[model samples]
Target chain A: MSAPARSTGVWTAAAGSAAAEPRETASAPPRRRSARRRRRWTGLAFAALPLAVYAVVVLAPLVQSIQYSFFKWDGVSAATWVGFDNYVTFVTDPILRSTFGHVLVLICFFALLPIVLGLFSAALLTRAKQPGMAVYRWIFFLPQVMTTVVIALVFKRIYAPDGPLNQALRAIGLDSLARTWLGDFTWALPALGLIGTWVTFGFCMVLFISGTSAIAPELYEAARMDGAGPFREFFAVTLPGLRGQLAVALTLTMTAALRTFDLVWITTHGGPGTSTLTPAVALYKAAFQNPQVGLAAAIGVVMAVLCLVVALVITRVSERD
Target chain B: MATTVAVVAGLALTMSACAPGGGGGSESSAQPSSISTDIASAGTVTLKMTDFWGSAEGKWIDQAIADFQKKYPNVTIDRTSEDWGQLNSTLNLQLQDDAGPDIASANNGWQSLGTLAKGGLVVNLDSYAKAYGWDSKVPTTIIRQNKFTTDLKTMGSGSWFATPMARTSLIGLYYNADKLKKLGIEPPKTLDELEVDAAKAKTAGEIPFQYGSLDGSTSALLGVQAVLADKNKLNDYVYDVPTVKASDVGMKEAVETVKKWADAGYFPKDFAGIDYQTAVANFVKGQGVFRWEYTGSLGLSTEQQKHFGYVQLPQSGGKTVGVGAAPGAMVISAKSKHPEVAAAFLDYLMSPAAGQTAVDLGLVPALSPDVKVPETSLSLTGESAAAKTLDSDDGYVPYFDWSSPTMLDTLGQNLQLVFAGKMDSGKFTAAVDADRDAFLAGQA
Candidate 1:
């Protein structure tokens, strides 16, 4: 920060000194200023379309959603101003409060677990060119490409009591271990979390692998010369090198975790007794099914704030170097 | 960027709250005096109809539309159909617009019907009802289900906002004939007899009930409510009677009975993991002795229908009451171009001919449940018989989900907790009561 500030200060001082030198530049400054003005107009013209589109599609709705959080609306009716009552309800309501805990648990699965496994796999797979590496890459990245709905449906069946998961447990003579994965209250959230891990670990792995490729090979060579094993070598070079990628992956996965709706909706619908409910599912039910559009807007605002905080923290921490 | 967003939001929020359907206020846009019931006055009229019956459930509606079209050649019906949840979720937005449907098939609950009615997006149907003599023709029980107060605070005694289009849903018990016969059990005549038979089935190494609770066990709760709920008492709760509590109408007893059945291992193993469709499919494949479902053998062949017997869960008092409603009820949108033609179409829906068409399509007719039709399948006969009995007795309790906007989610989630032994019936009752009280308080 200090280096950049000092450099900017120097540049400004240089520019000021140049401007102050009035030896021959009476008409020259105006020409340069006009040229700069014309360039600025061109830049504005180029940006006008996207700016308009973004304002209409994103900004207007965002403003409306914030406005909606302050009222009591049944979508079609005259909205009643309730001030911060919806936000208060979101905080005090037990069912709504429980959803935040579910998202936190999901973040462990969707973000942390994936990053660990992703880094592990990237270390192993990207260390050397192995036969069938392309096939492995394809297999790992498969979940990232499939639609969340389809993935959820497939996982729903797989986690069924008689699905292949339980059947496999039974086949291994672990009959007592077999239970309905998605239906059990103790297991439902974790079962959903495992699906999150399955879908995101591959993307994280691909991200880390790409990040590793950008690292200087000399760092690895030096670590090897120092008699460092694979574990030490990874810590010494690969780990530090992938910080930016880790931040990117963390931001994306954490937000995905926070905004999880369709997967939970298609699978459990926050069911077997609200064991798997998330904020997004609650928002949808409030807005669509319960017709509490105001409460839904409040949930949306809170979720957006949470996601923004997570992203900002990750970005700031990653940029600390 | 942040300052700009704050300014925009502050300016908008100060100007107006975002009333989702925009600024008509909560009064009926089309007054009773302005609405004409003269179908002949509107010549070459095209009425856009939006409905939620696009699947096999739509056959009866399609037949009704055809019959109505034949009666009025001058009116052309332009229809759009989608799934039930999809349609209801978007119906408010559609109805608020000028080019929205003339008539829309709406769900019975507060979220769809009550909300739309309160917003004045749909026309008040009292004028049309009197014009078409619906009070005398449509059964009071069915009509009561569609009525909501002009304020939309309570239902069952108010001006009509929607009318059932010949079809309604009924909850009842379905048994496998061969399985019952093999177990040496006659059709259970009472709840005790049913429980005894279930015990026998359990001892005989057969799944007594083909139960799937992934749907929050609401269907099973409906079946339980059929056995347990007192029609009048349940009415007090569902119709927003202020003094009544949820536990007053045997709700806890119903929950206890379901929990007892769960403890007895009467339901299929891992039943919570199975969905309704899969459980129905399993029942058809002879996996369970009995199944609780709505009044249709949807996937059954005629032979299969004959082998399966449909009956209401037997009540101790020899009265039939169940979780049922006019699921395909239609209302005229305030934005409709042809209000009278729409009213006529709705009136035609309550006609005996339309009821006959509903029966022919294996749908339970709401208006005239006793309309005679050739009984090619025994299950249809049983459904009609059950519907007729309920109608005569005024025995239909609105599916309790209509009690509160969030009641569906509350019942669904908490019922699973009760079943899973994570929560008791008392807590479940409290959760439900909280939702109801909150909604009722909002009304006040």
Candidate 2:
């Protein structure tokens, strides 16, 4: 920091000397102020489309959902006033409460493992000069590219009790390990989590890789000159440099974990005694199928809060000096 | 349309403080005034019909549409077919508006009929029932299927709100006769004999029962219902007859008996892993001796139907009690522009031509049996067999899950646990009873 300040003082001195030689410094201040004002206006103009879209699509629905949380409505007939009853249901109902537990379970697969695997891979890639890197990227990113429902369907067949998974287990004489993977009470939720892992890890890896590229080569060389080993270089340079990427990955992946409905719906339907049930699936059924819009809205409000809180924490930590 | 959606959404927001279905700002002005009783209507009206029938089952509907259009060319029929879940959810919300379908086969529960009736989203057909002499024309038992109290809490009691054109579904044991004969086994004569047959068929390397519980274990419920032929208190349990407990001793016995079957390996290996379509396909190819499914739809070629025999899953007392009686019912939306024309078109659905179509397609006629069934192109053996079982001493019991909206989810979740060996019979029945008790408490 002292070296940078000293260099900046020298540069300012050079700039002062240059400015002293017939420069229009008074006009420049006003012109720079006008330019700054123009830039701010341009930024606002660019933000208008997304702002309007967010207002109409996201903001209105979110506000309505929060409002709906206070009612007792079945989507038809009349909605009745039942303050906090829907929220109380989520807190009290065993099934609904357990759905929140499933979200925590999914976080391990969706966010935690993806972050570690992504950081590890990005670190390794930064070490080597490799050819045919795009092929590796495509192979790794294929799961993220495919539709979740289609991926879920393929995995359904693979995890089916009598499917190829069991066949392979039998062929290798590990028959006991090959029960219906998604149907077992103990294994169902984890099996679903692993699919979440497969889907998200690739995306995180790509994100971290791009972030690693933006990291300067000078840092690694400087650490090497200081006699730091490969492992130390990763911790002292790679990790610290990749903080913003880590924050982005964690935020996006945490949202994915919290809002996981489609895969669970397509594959399990929260079956085998609600072992694989998630809040999103429960909220959807409550809203659309049972028409318990009030309860669904309460759940939605909680979900929105979770997303906002995650985003806030991520941005806060990243922005911390 | 967006404006209409926004208006209703706003209305919903403001009316949350009010009592259900009433005394809010807007009245249900779309209610038809004095529906026509005439069997004929020559008005220039297009009636939109909503049902959950696919192409195969929809053939009957298409035939009815073609015939109705020929007879009343001035009336056009626009049809929309949705899957059951989508149809139920959409119609439940949309029925309150004038933009909903003119005619629909309503889901027969508190969700569809109860709310729709209480909210005045459907036309009350009592006056029309009288004018058409439907009281005598349709069977007392069958027509009563549409009866619902004004509050919709009670069923089988109040004004007629809907009418049926055909019986929807019946759960039965459809068996492969050739396979049965090869094993020298008649379709089980009793519940005990059914168990013995299942054991024997399993030993003989044939799947005893074709079953799949993935999409709610409803087929397993059919197996449970087959063992409990005591239909005396079923109505009390299902229709929310007050002071009724769903934990029937006979039902408990049925649950244990099914558990024992699972224990004894009577179910197909990986039966829990498969789905309804795969189970049906396996049965059609003679992979299983008995498949518990709807009696009306064999969906087989004449050659395939010949190899099979349909029976009311071996009665306990020589009295065959089945699940699902009234099938689904067709009702005119209160919001319909031409309620009279829609009502006339509904009458046409029970016509002799439609009845013939029902018979030919091996479908159950919801037309009061006063109308003669037409001879069909396929052999009538399966339909006759189904009809014989249906036309027995005891009446059919409504499905247990159809009592409440969330009952299916409860039954599906807990009962699948029973099949998975995670929960036993007592626990399964208790869980269901608790669910039912909670539902009743909520309603109260």
Candidate 3:
């Protein structure tokens, strides 16, 4: 087949053809073929170490967990093959089933809230000619750097009935609003979700800020020259430019929300009933606390699949742009 | 791709090999006959032990270890101590490998002790018990608490799997004397009087009980001993007695009493949000009239203990019933290279000297006639509480959580729901019964 006369540099379709030529030319020249073969072997040799480590560390345990998911093992005793019994419990059992709902609510705080706030702040920070922008960026990224346990513990105190949050509310004559934030059944899940929002929104903002800076300045100038206000310019230029960053933010935040354990574990432990119970906490309890290793493995497999699907969906949706 | 597949397959096989194999069941012949109470003959043996007792509460065990080392200078003891949560989470996995501690402090339940015993990771201590005269030194009930069936399915019977390193008495009602005096209330003699006092304290704008439900605090379960009519029934329920339901053991009454307290605003406001530590801290700061606690008292300073008085809650029937549990049972590992030395170490752990150290450090040792308590020791009040329960006709009940692996979670979560008014006492009992039923069904 004849190639196109014009090519789009190294990433063009011609590059694929060029890479394939070395394999396609079987008897073209012995020296060239041997050189090509040597190059291929050297690349493989270089890749072998990391590949082996990944296989042992990641792939091996993943396969073992999947295998363990099908059996009833108490970690100490002999495992009995229970097929999908453990997996079935996740759907059939109300307590386990409710964890999925809790995670969905958390995604609103951990993923959606962060994304919206991140975009708004990124846009504002980028447009403003404010001094100490680096300082502002650092402030926004503080929560991402702080230890999760310290954050959880600090937030636990802040949400206490007589804590500063309640004290401030009471001081403002909102006495009726002051209640056990983490203890109330109706409020515990949301209370934890808000903590998630606080901890994650910073990371999202920093991600979007970098993404916004990377956008071509001429695009924003073109939108502004078209008689567009800041809002219109943002919608026209900034939002479209953030498609890849938004996808990354969504995938990271969504997975983080889904697998939240330490925060809930430290604060409520899915208490005041199983109100704040996340899938990760449930998996942990099953694995270690209850010694239901097989069930925990099943939950692990399910969570991995869910996170993978979410990341793939975000990637596919972003690629459409 | 073929190489990747081969690598993946090879890694998978390696992991499978690392996984602990089946057939952990104990055979009669597997019990080594060379067991001795003396380790001096072992020739400079280093016995490794793991325990959950960190510095604060580890005083007794630390003393015991030091004393043992002095006694058997040839036997150098290596100890790894972590907090309860950290130690328990990793203990079983550690014991599964040969490199695990020669002896580890295992939690006294089917999930921890029973699982370890059943898996044959921990040795049966019946032979050691006989050699060490643990029967005479430790009370029968305390000894039975660590006993388990050969199958390790049932607790409180059959072979001795472990012995108490240190014992925690039935959770006692600890009251602030100054607060009680300020409210013009006398120390309660019965559950009714306790309720009346609590109501009075509430009316006086003081927290009657500084309880927190966060982290699944068992204050309510412990406090329920006041009204618990039959200790053996609750004990049976915890030991996986299939015919007995949680309802039959006055669990509803327990839940209802907690509900009464919650409705009365006796517990700290937003008690569900407050953790056990904060509640105890608040109690120490004079925030509440009473604090139902067990090992928490061990952490109290002398100044705090001056105003604090502990009592085994008395029933209206003139008999006191309470729940008591050991912090953990010290068990020799089946994989230990020096089983006899580990046995001797365990024997030393429950000795009179160790018991004195436990008392001095504000902990209750296992009931021993030989273990004398100093009169000036502030632990006398707590010791008397345990003594009262030990002497009472109803005796002491085991912790309700010990009944099933998930019982603690089920009970703790539902108890919070009951206090939050999201669930009633009936539903609470049913939830626990359901958990028990499920565990029992699985066992069958």
Best model number under DockQ: 1
Interface RMSD of the predictions, in order shown?
Answer: 2.0, 3.8, 3.0
Model 1 per-residue lDDT tens digits across residues A200-254: 9999999999999999999989999999999999998999999888987887788
Sort candidate 1 into its docking category. acceptable
| Candidate 2 lDDT by residue in tens digits, A185-237 | 78888988999888888888888889888889898889999999989998998
Off by over 4 Å in 1: A1-37, B1-9, B12-22, B29-43
The candidate with the higher TM-score, 1 or 3, is 1
Q: What TM-score does chain A of each model score against the native chain A?
A: 0.89, 0.86, 0.88
Tens-digit lDDT track of model 3 for B207-312? 8988888778876665674356476677777777788887889888888877888887888877877888888888888889987887455366766666777777
Error of 3 at B264 (Å): 1.2
| Alpha carbon lDDT at B251, candidate 3 | 85
State the C-alpha lDDT per candidate. 0.82, 0.72, 0.78
Best by lDDT: 1
Separate DockQ for every predicted complex? 0.49, 0.29, 0.43
Q: What is the TM-score of each candidate against the true structure?
A: 0.92, 0.88, 0.89
Chain B TM-score of all predictions, in order?
A: 0.93, 0.84, 0.88
True contacts kept of 3: 0.63
lDDT, candidate 1, at B332: 89
lDDT of 1 at B419: 83
